[model samples]
Target chain A: MSGAEDFLRARGLWRRKPRGEGWLLSDVRLTVRGGQRLAIVGPSGSGKTLLLRALARLDPLDRGEILWRGEAVVGNRVPDFRRHVIYLHQRPVLGEGTVEDSLQAPYRLNVHRASRFDRQRLVEWLRLLGRDAQLLTRRQRELSGGEAQIIALLRAIQLQPQVLLLDEPTAALDADATLAVERLIDVWMRQDDTARATVWVSHDQQQAARVSTKMLALQQGRLQGGGSC
Target chain B: MLNPTYIELDASRVALAALLILVNGAISLALRLGMARTLLVASARTVVQLVLVGMVLQWVFGDRPWFVVLGLLMLMTFIAGVTAVQRNQRRYPGIWTDTMISVWVSSWLITSFALLVVIRDMQPWYQPRYAIPLLGMVLGNTLNGISLGMNALTEALVTRRDEVESLLALGASRWEAAAAAVRHAVRTGMVPIVNAMMVVGVVSLPGMMTGQILAQAEPLQAVKYQIVIMFLVASATGLGTVGVILLGYRRLFNADHQFLYDQISE
Candidate 1:
């Protein structure tokens, strides 16, 4: 229950209809510590993505409180929380520009104004992901889905967020690209901070097992508890 | 300065002017343009509306009451606001309020500033002759701009919700996230006014100048008044468009800065 050591914690999280339908996500409770890769897996329409979005503050929760590092994430602090707790969509959307422009986009925000887009660090991460300097020059629209996904993965990792809420991030990628993403995340986890965490939503049980140390099973919008798979 | 003799149109002259519409209708019918009924109805509607408006203007002009002038402006603003907000294909929550505030503020400010500060000729600031017509012109143009801007913004926000959410997740402020839509809306709104300004003296004779010249006013005097109106309309349209977009984009997100899907109509 100590908040200081917890990376991201959700208490009694639920999303439901105001009038008719049952809960989309119900009474889900989970705590993630630093450096843990937690996989949220469920059948389609089970609200797996909903839980992650709720955690990332991307979706409004009908009932629950999400705490980051033990403090309630609310108000002006929500942006600060978002800066650390980033959400990566399944189909990445890049601004109208080159890949480098997309990579450098985040720095335009006041929250990230103190940080600059380090070209050396971006190149390093791209190299780790089996990409190279030439990839940065390619136009965003010209990129293949897998290449775009890689760029998205790199964009989130480049920000050095504390927790990454990834919703089927590798859904469009090939086996090679998927492996590259997994390897890049592994390297990111082993970086100097050693306090970063990620909650990855995946349909592929095998890939989930390979990528995440702990697994959360969701069925009919309710958590089936840890390791139920 | 040459002495100007004003020629007034009699009832027979007015009826003769109405014959122009029959000629237009004849052309439409002969061409099988399908616009025959629409043109006739529109022509009739214009005659009725103008005659009614002329009577009202004569009353207000004869009296020169400030309240009457201001009341008419307020009425115009209310109609303009409703028209602007309803322009969206699918209306969203709070859109009416957003549009109303934007249209009212921009239209009122620009109209008043142009009439009182810029021109500074009316005996009483709210002189019905000057205030009613000038304010009416500005509000009419501003209505079009705000409507176009709001429609563009709402459509963009609804269609590109994912992109906006992605930007928000990148720690961008709501303004930053909706920057593309805002730019698009403002530019779209301003385009008509810009185009009108570009062709004011070359391609076509604008309504105000044409009206003044027809009323036997000096060409230079009419030109000066037309220039003032054009400037005011452009300023009001730009302001109104930007105002609506600015007020509108914030409403697309909630307190936590998440995109409000419910606010966007399907």
Candidate 2:
């Protein structure tokens, strides 16, 4: 099952409680192939976020290794790995600046030093989402929750990462904003379908069915069932 | 001008000054603050600790060898390190070692520069009378800075865990992710010494300067020494704060750029 098409693979991924108690996530294995939109659905406390974080290598793994393009992701490569496999928090955190500054922030990182912010592309995306270039000039603190999430999503997508581990990116958005986010992700994935994939952790099964071709269910820190929607 | 003679105080005169604690004890009693016992114990401790330190300094100043002087300075550095860490309300693994390294390196470096390069006329650079007092002032101030910086850094890291993690997730190196917190911590640590510098001659007469003046050294000479001490303290504090904060940043994040926020405990 691990093939060239497999962009990211997690085998026997496990994370223990900080106090050395039972596992918060254990024995979870999944594969993300190019052009795959995988949605993980679970009730609260089901470790969906934990699993996504573990996959992104944002959280330490106790029992499993994450493989990128058929090689084990290890030290030194982790930074570059994270650069390609970006994780978006459920509630976005934006620094104190205009939306453009927040978008430009990632390019400042050493990993993305070669990348430049594409202001025109951002404005075009904003037009598609029914926003104008003025949104970029708005102060981040003045942004609505939906606007902040939009900026956060654009920030990650602009980096052109190969994989996105989105932890309920729209959990705080209203219906219209959610649709805008889903549309943006759809457009981004299709732009380079052969090299892109996303793992969405959503509470909305209907939205999951709409956004994902493959769906997985999690419960009590374990995978229960997974199949194409 | 006549040479001014220094007046000496006997134990009886010191005891008379010690009676001032009774005023504090009476206030606590009147207010029913239940702090009278603590007040008495702390005052007693102050007298005992100072007397003990005075005795130790007397013995060391009595023609002690260089090794003995260095040993006493090391001891003072160790105690300052421990005290700095103990003042923290949070804990993490290896924090003590980090604090110790910062305190020892910063204080010793600046103290040595002051003793060797700045005050070159001493027959021996490690003379107890000069080195001990210089190192003590530097160590004391550096301890304050390290304690303040470490506390602020750890607290910011814990409180701003999500912000840090978000930055890490976006491919920020550990240094980039922690830059804001490091700046804040370093600034916090250096504030005291900076403020002391601002008010040194105008708003306050520093204890060392006052002591030198009482010891019949020329007032201008005392001012020069105090000026040197202030600059030494500011440099030591700034260096210690930066060192400890960087060390702490390394501890809180890993080589993979992942934030190990759980390592810290309130």
Best of the candidates, lDDT: 2
How far is each candidate from the true structure, as Cα RMSD in Å? Answer: 3.1, 3.0
Pick out the ten consecutive residues of candidate 2 chain A with the lowest summed lDDT.
A220-229
TM-score per candidate: 0.91, 0.92
| Model 1 local distance difference test score | 0.84
Against the true structure, whose DockQ is highest?
A: 2
**Chain A alone, TM-score per model:** 0.93, 0.94
- Per-model clash counts, in order, read 0, 0
Per-residue accuracy of model 1 over B1-266 as CA lDDT, tens digit each: 14446676688998898788889889989999988799888988988999999899888888766787788889988998988777677677788898888888988898889877988887887888888888788888998998888888877887888889898887876667788888998999999999999999899999889989987889999999999999999999999889888877778767777777676674
Off by over 4 Å in 2: A1-4, A225-229, B1-4, B19-39, B65-67, B123-125
DockQ of each: 0.66, 0.72
lDDT, candidates in the order shown: 0.84, 0.89
Candidate 1 lDDT score at position B48: 92
Where does candidate 1 stray beyond 4 Å? Answer: A1-4, A18-21, A192-194, A226-229, B1-4
